[model samples]
Target: MKTIQVPTREQVNEEAQALFDQLQKRLGKVPNLYATIGYSAHALQAFLQFETSLNQGAFTGKEREAVALVVSQVNGCNYCLAAQTMAAVKRGLTQEETLLIRSGRASDQKMNTIVQLAKSIAENKGKSAQNLLAQFFEAGYSEAALIELTGLVTVRIFTNYVYALTAIPVDFPAAQPLPYALQEQPQS
Candidate 1:
């Protein structure tokens, strides 16, 4: 099997270099997934723009991280699962709560709805059932929030697929493996 090389900050073009410098300043290092995108500066810039825009949207930081956790779990992307687990902690979720979110559950009713909807959207490829959509709004999310949630799911999916394709080395601390009982079985 061939390994996809993650580009070093030194190896990327000027645009990517600037982005890497910024990322390093903020995050202390360029994560391998972002570095993979750095191989195409335009792609890196576009992804950064898209992600930053979503961060400014209707979801609270914890809610957004919840969406990311459930989506990453559904997609079985360990790289994102690990990264988002850490991000979720920084956003104030207890490690146990993060694990529960990944398993499509949450102690908070509203967040449970959000995680379930994100899981369904990702597992079903954006073809989530109407009842799930209704539940999201019934839980008090606006149509605008739903739209933003969909966008967030799409962004996470992009990174999930990228990491899956590249089999990139995870740069974050390894998340605890989802217990077998918590693992979602593949739909037949």
Candidate 2:
């Protein structure tokens, strides 16, 4: 069961209410994740801010989606995986591109650079590998853009951990996990 109930548009506060209204207006419904995050107004505001900024990231639409997809895969967050996949497709990623990011291997030569860097950063928990950061910089992202990407990743971690705890039903099918593959098993 969810630790927090997913309050309907009416159940949310008049002050915290705008978040609900905005979500419904933009996404047609409040995501279960957002509803739960509404327990704290700051949490909900942070999520919305990060989401909007990341959506306007320095990378092109597809490039930003690729970064999101790679982070979702590494985090092993099925909810994020599905949500981002849907966003990626809507942003014009080919089905093949989506699969590649979900699988942690980009088939597109140009995109492989971004995917590898994003994966390395996620795996390292933001203690970014120096060489990889250099590579990401060399690939043309500015320092400011890198900061924005970190903000984006942090927001994702918030959602990913929430799902791990709640196991909430993914309202967006794009949030599913990649196909089963070699992954570390929890030790007894």
TM-score of each: 0.94, 0.84
lDDT of 2 by residue, 105-144 (tens): 6777547767777777788888777777787788778888
Worst 10 residues of 1 by lDDT: 176-185
Pairs that clash in candidate 2: 82-174, 82-175, 82-176, 83-174, 83-175
Q: Which number leads on TM-score? A: 1
Candidate 1 residue runs with Cα over 4 Å from true position = 184-188
154, model 2: CA deviation in Å?
A: 1.5
Best by lDDT: 1
Model 2 TM-score relative to the real fold: 0.84
CA shift of 143, model 1, Å: 1.5
Off by over 4 Å in 2: 1-3, 174-188
